[model samples]
Target: LLSDGRAQGYVLNDDIFVFLGRGKIAGLPVMVWILILTAVAVHILLKYTDIGRNLYAIGGNDTAARLAGININKYLIAVYALIGTVA
Candidate 1:
């Protein structure tokens, strides 16, 4: 599809030139900045946020987390929403 230009109007292609400018950063495409920023944000969230801690706890042991007073259902819903948004 990319070879045929079918995906040309997609979000990345649509804004790549505008958002990334016409230059490279640290020998990588400027678009890589988005990936770096996203990684940093996720790292910070998992390291310092309550929701992130809850998510880790649930992943480690759902039964224990629920018994420990974490709202498993709410966190599951939030996880689903986050997955949907990222998709």
Candidate 2:
């Protein structure tokens, strides 16, 4: 959109759409702030959450994880749903 200017025709080429446009929060781009905040949140979740631990265990070994009483099928479905939503 920025490179071709096609978004301008639809009135969507404003500051929000343009990566270099003027709109900063605390001297950082809004997109950068969003990315930073998302990363921090994910880090915290993975570090301190039960689901996060379960996810790690599943990644290390599915058979062991299942044997250890983790619901492999449910977690796998949840993971796929999360991935689909994110993508």
Candidate 3:
């Protein structure tokens, strides 16, 4: 759709459509690799990083997270942007 949702919709190029729909690595589909890679990366980030701790803290209590030196607004904005991009 257009920016204001005034148009019908968007379309992907045929080459790109076929490339992603049919491309494989070693016998696995491209999407499978993408999913696995994203899952692993997110798991590592959320389970083993200070940013993850701050994010959790923010989720629990914004005031406490802020007092603890976690920039709640930054993380909240970043999370929303990431989600919007993915969606």
Candidate 4:
């Protein structure tokens, strides 16, 4: 998106603490929607995707997954790189 200049206004300008404290539920403030959406998406992906299965297999045992033709190292590195970028 950035490469094509499509993310120009897709920026989070608010402070984290303000967003956290200002977010609300019924009669109380909280940041639950983000967590709930994340949980649902993870559940759906893990239960219904091959990539999720491959990830679980790699996590269980890299050597066994490799013997079964799973590219454990590539997935691990990709996951790490994603985390690095997000951080």
Please provide, for model 3 over 1-87, each residue's C-alpha lDDT reduced to its tens digit, 9 standing for 90 to 100: 346756565566688777778889889998889889888987888889987888889889899989988878889899889768756
**Cα lDDT tens digits for candidate 4, 28-69:** 557576667667877887789997899899889889999999
RMSD (Cα, Å) for all candidates, in order, is 5.8, 5.8, 4.4, 7.5
List the candidate numbers ranked by lDDT, top first: 3, 2, 1, 4
Indicate whether candidate 2 or candidate 4 has the larger TM-score.
Answer: 2
Candidate 2 runs further than 4 Å off = 1-9, 13-22
Q: What TM-score goes with each of the models?
A: 0.66, 0.70, 0.70, 0.61
Residue 29 accuracy (lDDT) in model 2: 84
Question: Which pairs in model 4 have colliding backbones?
Answer: none
lDDT assessment of candidate 1: 0.82
Please report how far candidate 3 places residue 17 from its true position, in Å.
4.0
Q: Model 3 compared with the native: what TM-score?
A: 0.70
Question: What's the candidate order when arranged by decreasing TM-score?
Answer: 3, 2, 1, 4
lDDT of 2 by residue, 10-70 (tens): 5656765665455688889877787787788878877899999999999999999999999
What is candidate 3's CA lDDT for residue 35? 82
Clash counts per candidate, in order, are 0, 0, 0, 0
The true-versus-predicted C-alpha distance at residue 57 of model 1, in Å, is: 0.7
**What do the candidate models score in CA lDDT, each in turn?**
0.82, 0.83, 0.83, 0.77
lDDT by residue (tens digit), candidate 1, 27-86: 887767867887788788888999889999999999999999999999999879977875
